[model samples]
Target: MYRLTTHSAIAEIPAEHWNRLADPDTPFLHHAFLDAMERHGCVGESLGWLPHHLALRDGDDRILAVAPAYLKFNSYGEFVFDWSWADAYRRHGRAYYPKLIVASPYTPATGPRILTGATPQRRDIARVLIQGAVQVAEKLGVSSLHWLFTADDETDWLAEQGSMRRLGCQFHWRNPGYGSFDDFLGAFTAAKRKQIKRERRRVAENGIRIRRVRGDAVTESEWAIFHRLYRDTFDKRGGLPTLTLPFFQDIGERMGRNLLLVLAYHDRNIVAAAFNLIGERSLYGRHWGCFQDFHSLHFDACYYQGLEYCIEQGLTRFEPGAQGEHKVSRGFLPTATWSAHWIANADFRQAIARFLDTETRDMQDYLAEMNTHSPYRADALPDRIQAVS
Candidate 1:
């Protein structure tokens, strides 16, 4: 027998125990990462990310499965677009806020939402976690339950659990055993490769030097400067930032090597920085901010720097956040991303199902179109690199 329980914080579960169920490749789902988000006021009931963590325990109180979850009031930090769905609900006089979401908050990178150990019974444990989530949603009377940016293997299970599958696209760069950034460029078309070279050269000609700082090597003062630039970007867009300065500081301490910054300096002064999180096999470019904009500093500090780091570090993949059609030209190719949803109300469920059906077709067509404009040389691309979806 298993008991399903919910806690208001990730700290409720021991990090050692929680990490045991987490996907080793996804550092974003680690206990310290989620706890840092909560302890530093980045996410909480007040901030609209009320932690509602789920766990499945056996008769002897051994944890068998866990889900990093939240009671979300609005979809601000979530990269998966669902604002229009909320509008649809409101138009029909239905409440959409305070819904249940199982995800790495604000992270669009794909991994498991329901984490299970390496036991042979892992499939059964996953089933229990999903069923428990549905029961909790019904008991709480929420309108919907969402699992965002889930890994591909979880899709069939989620669909079997009565969730509608949705397809989205994000640009990602895959390593093809390149020994250097130049080798990476060699695979691209001559025109595109020249364009990339010009972008990097322009940043250098503008008197900017970029450095990669990892973890504590980044001083408290520099982190402050980074956050100021970070907030400045949000201020320009009239947006709110979910992660706070203390939050970044805390993760920098806890995650150590997993945290890094691609910092850009102009005239010996800090002008911009791109914050990235590292995993065993991937580098995730999550945040970027600049005190001032230069001709091509963003591409240099964000995309090019990350690609270089991935090759140098022997990482297999680089995900540069969500929804950047512009990233396609810079050697980041179109990659399919997935999310799943369970709508409670039947009528609304049908409406969303119809919408997703159409959206999926549009997304597939768009991905195909984007591929036709692929930046890599037609003959240079490996089949695995070109055929990813």
Candidate 2:
């Protein structure tokens, strides 16, 4: 038997039980990560991300599966970009706020959505959890439901359930069995190679030095400065900071080694910083902020610094956040991202389906054009990578 309930807090669910459902390889899905978000007040009713997490319990009252869900009043931090869809609903005199979102708050990296036990009944558990979302959407009379930045398995199952699928692209760097940073750079074309070298040189010439400190090396004072940078970066753009300083400090203290902080200093004064999360095989470049905008500083701090770290650490992939064609020129390759949605209204559902069909094809074409301008040599491109566009 399966039971459903709205979780008031992530702590309401035991950490051990939640961790059991998550893959040990992906730390972002772990209980500590979600708990830190809520515990630090980064997510909750006040932040417009009310936790309505779903769980499947067995007859023995053991947690079998789970999904991180939220009741969203507006879509801001979600990189999946659904504002136009919301606007269309309003144009047609429909209410679009208060939609149910099953995703990681303020995170766009794809990972498992449905966490089930490794037993014969696992598939059924996933189905039931998905059905729970649909039922809840209907009961609440929300405009739609969305499962953003989900892994391939979740997308496949949701598609089978007739959910409208959408495709977006992000640039990610993959290690191609390179032994060192130099070896990795050798794969790039001659001109692009020289360009990267110049950019790194510019950072050094500007009296700025970059350092990578992980885990315990990140002090509270460093986090406070980084938080200010993060807030200023968002505030300057006329938006509110989605995360709190305490949240960063908490994650750094608890998941220190997994936390990679790239700091840029000028004359021993920190001017900019980028915070990244290191998973088992991938590095997620999530946030960055700088007090001053030095030439080529953003690229050096965000892209070059992260890529070099990945190569040195022998990590498999580096996903430096979302939406940057400029990253492609610096050796990041185009990769397709998936998000699945279920609109409660039939008319809106059909309309979105029609839009997605055309959008997917256009995205494919855009990626194809991007490939022709890749920084890598033709011989270095693997068959699988070549077929991405």
Candidate 3:
């Protein structure tokens, strides 16, 4: 028999046990990453993201599956926006806060929401985990449960359990065994290829030098500089900078090798940086900040540099964070991202279901239209456009 458990903090679970089930393709799912957030106060009741992680274990207390989850009081860091849903609840005189969410806070990358390792009974374990999460929602009397930025397969499982599947789009670059950056660009049309070249050259012409530094190789001073850039950017934009210097320092110490920082230097002074996490077969870009704007520096540090590193390292894909239609014109292709929701109120659930039906159709149309704007030559386009399932 299997039993479900919930912990108020990730530290309640052993890193080895949790990581054994976690996918290496998503560093954000790492126990160390979640633990650091709790340790540094990046997530808590004050930040409106309270850790309420889920774990499934056998009779002997051996963990079979795990999920990074939160009792969300407000939808702040979750990149899958649902502010309208919250407003709808308010309009109906219902509460939406204190909902349960299964996601990596502040991250929008898709991976396993339920981390079930190579167990022969993986499907059964995942089903139990999902049921357990919904049960928790019931016990807490929350409005709903959400599985955000989930893997395609997990979305199917959640939908089978009657969760409303929602489709979204993100721009990503795929590596098709390109020998070099130039080789990768060769797949693009001549005009598009030249456009990319011009952007790269503009950065160089502006005397901005970008260096890809592995996390382990980054000095303490460099981390401080990067943190300042990150925090300042958030401040300037009137957004809360929740991730702290200590949090970055902690992750750098625990999982440094998985980190990649693209630092842009102008006249020997660091001006901008892109924070990325390396995965088994992907490069996941998380954060970027700059003190001063340089010509095409964002493109170089955020997109092109990531693409080049993926090519050089033989990584298969580059997911440079979320939602940028502008990326379509610069070699990144529109790809489907999935999320699933379980609503507690029957009437609201039906309304949401109907809304999702229409939204899904609109999303399909959006993806098809976006595909028409592919930068690659007609014969060389990426063949991985996934329709909403």
Candidate 4:
């Protein structure tokens, strides 16, 4: 037997129960991470993300699965870029707000969506959880439901269950059994390698020193400066900041080692910073900002620093946020990402299906073209890794 419940609070779910379904490899899915987002008030109805997490239980009330879900009033923080879909609904005289989104708020890192228990009923739990999402959409009268930046396994499973799968691309750097940063850089072509070296040299010539501060090492003053930079960056882009100051403080206090802040200081004064989450096997670069523009500072602080940290830490992969063709030449390979959407309205669903099919083809071609310009040597490219849409 399967039971479904809507949870307004992450604390309501037992930490051990949720952690049981989470792989130690991915820290973002750990109960601590989600709870921090909630405890800090970063996710709630007023913030445009209302927690309505779905929990599945067995006959004896044992938790089987859980999905981090939210009721989204807008698609601002989700990096998957679905504003066009919302506009399409409005153009067709339909409502698109209040859609059900299964994703991490203000995060584009792909991970498991359905957390199932270690039992024969794991698949059944996923089916039930998805059905619960559909039911919630119908009951709440929302226009649609979406699962953003999900892993390939969940995407395939959802597609098998009639959800429409959409393809996207992100540039990520993966370690190829590299023993050191220089070894990894050796794989790059001479021109690209020279370009990177020049960029690093430029940052150094400007009297800027970059340092990585782990969670515990991040002082309150540092957090304040980082938050200001984060807000200023969003403001300059003419958008509201997605994260609250308290969110940063809480993450620093609770998950400090998992938090890596790459700070660029000029004359011992901080000028730029890149906030990254350190997982067991991957480093996820989430946000970046600079107080002043310096030549190649952004690249040094965001990409190169991240790569160096990953190399030194022996991490397997580094995902430096979303959507950058320039990352290809910086040794980040084009990787395909997947999302699933469900539009309750039949007409809108068909329209989106048509649009997605064409978009997928275009994305596929774009990834292939980008791969041709990859920095890595031809033999260094892994056979398992390919650009797909």
Candidate 5:
């Protein structure tokens, strides 16, 4: 028999135990990353991200499966945008603030939601974790339960258990054993390849030098500069910069091997930087900021640098955060992202089910449309798509 338990903090579970079940390819799901958010005050009730992680324990109290979860009071950080659903609930004189979600707070990259090892009973353990999460939602009397940016297989598992599957899309670059950036670009059509080269040249023409630095190699002063850029950018854009400096510092110390910072320099000073997490098989682009805006600098610092790094590092994929169709033209292809929802209210559930069905069709059509505009040469298209898949 297995027992389900919820902890208000990730620290209640040991890091080794938690990470043993996590996919090494997903840095966001690492114990150090999630714990840093909690320890650095990035997530809390005040921030609408209260950590209420779920764990399934065996008879001897050993954790067999785990899911990083939260009781959200608002729809601020989760990228799966459920504001419309929340608004609908509000219009109906119902509450949607305290919804339960299984996700890495403020992260939209797809990975394991129900974490389990390669044991024979992995599937069984995942099922229990899902059911346990639902039971917790019911006991808490929350409006709904959501698993955001979940792995394709886990999303399927959630749907098998009656959760509503929501389809979304992200532009990701896949490395098909390219030896270098130039080699990778060779797959692109001549026009698109020239466009990409022009964009990279713009950064050089502006006297901006870009470099990729590992977390451990980054000095304290450098981190401060990057944090400043991050905050200033968010301020200018009128978005909240929730991840604190301390959080970045802590993660830099604890998970340095998994962290990558892309810095752009002009005049021997730091002007912009992109923060990313490096996984065993993937590189995840997270945040970016620039003190000086140079033409095409954002593309170079964020997307191009990430792509180059992935190619050099032998990483198979690069997920440069979420929702930028322009990335598609830059050799990144549209890939399907998913989320699963379980609404407690029967009426709302049925309504959401219908809405998702329509939305799913729309998403399907959108992905198909996006594919027709692939930047790769006709002869290279087959291999490129297969690599991404």
Candidate 6:
């Protein structure tokens, strides 16, 4: 027997118990990270992120499963774009706002969505969480429910349970047991190898130096500068800067060693920065910005430096944010991303099923296309596609 409940805030749950069920390698799902958003005023009804986290409990009242969910008013921060679906609902004089999303808010990285203990009843717990979420959505009368950027294994299970599976591509770099960055580059073709080397050389020749500062070591003033750079990134592109300054400070304080800041200096002045969250087995490249434009500085601050860090730290994978095909040529291979949807309306669900079927085929063909032109040398290509979950 099981009981399911939803909370309006993550703080209602204990951090220790929640983390005990999470993969240590994915820091975005950490209680500290999600709670920071709420505490720092980044998420709330006014901000369009209303918390509605789901939890499954056992007969003894022990929490057996959990899923981080939100009642979204609009499709802003979720990188799994659903604007078209929203537009469809609007055309039919229906509502899309208040739809339920199970995800790490504002994060596009894939990790565990349905978290549970490693007990014999883990699958049963997941089912309860899923059904509980759907019941909550139906009660709220929302048009749909979505699970975004989910793990591959869970995505397969959701599809089997009648959820519509959608596919998208993101470029991610993998460490191939290389001794150093140079050794990693050796796997690339001669032309690409020289191209990357030249890009790195451009930064040094321009008298720009990069320093990788751990979060605990960062001063209060440094955190301010990093936030400014992050704001500048969205300001320049005319995008909403969803993250708050306090949020940055909070994560640094609570997530300490898990945070890494890569700052670029030219003439003793900070010109750019890239922020990463270090996990036990992976490094996640999240925020990046620059005050001044230097030649190939984005590559250095964003990609090359992170790659070098991964090699030095012996990290197995690096997920540098979302949607940049240009990263593919820079040794970041095209990887498929997953999202599962439950449409409440049967007619609309069938329509989306047809659409997703076509999208899935096209995504498969696109991945095959990217593989034919992978940056790695012919001999270095792996025998099997790396299933990034």
- Candidate 3 residue lDDT tens string, 1-389: 98999999999999999999988888989999999999998999899998999989999999999999899999998988889999999999999988999999999998889999877887888988998888999999999999999888789889999899999999888886889999888888999899999999999999988899999889999999999999988988999999999999999999998999999999999999999999999999999999999988998899999998998899999999899888988878888999999999999999989999999899989988998898888777656643323
Q: Flag the better candidate by lDDT, 2 or 4.
A: 4
| lDDT of the structure predicted as candidate 6 | 0.88
Candidate 4 structure quality by residue, lDDT tens digits, 104-171: 88888877788884567667678788887788778989988899988787888788877899988899
Model 4: worst 10 consecutive residues (lDDT sum): 380-389
Report the lDDT tens digits of candidate 1 across residue range 1-389: 98999999898899999999987778899899999999988898787899999999999999999999899999978888899999999998989998999998889998778899677887788888899999999999999999999878677788998999999999888897999999999998999999999999999998999999997688998899999989988999999887899998888888868987989998888999999989889999999999888998999999999999999999999999998889999988889998999999999999999999999999999998888778898899857768756
Which consecutive 10 residues in model 5 have the weakest lDDT in total? 380-389
Q: Estimate every model's Cα lDDT from 0 to 1.
A: 0.90, 0.84, 0.91, 0.86, 0.91, 0.88
What is the alpha-carbon lDDT of model 2 when measured against the actual structure? 0.84
What candidate 6 gets wrong by more than 4 Å, as runs, is 384-389
Tens-digit per-residue lDDT, 85-139, candidate 2: 9999899999889999988888888778887745677677888788877888788
Listed in order, each prediction's TM-score against the native is 0.98, 0.95, 0.98, 0.96, 0.98, 0.97
Q: What value does the lDDT take at residue 356 in candidate 6?
A: 91
Better of 3 and 4 by TM-score: 3
Scored against the true structure, residue 63 in model 1 reaches a CA lDDT of: 92
Question: Candidate 6's residue-wise lDDT over 28-68, tens digit each?
Answer: 99999999999999899988999999888889988888889
Among all windows of 10 consecutive residues in model 6, the one with the lowest summed lDDT is: 380-389
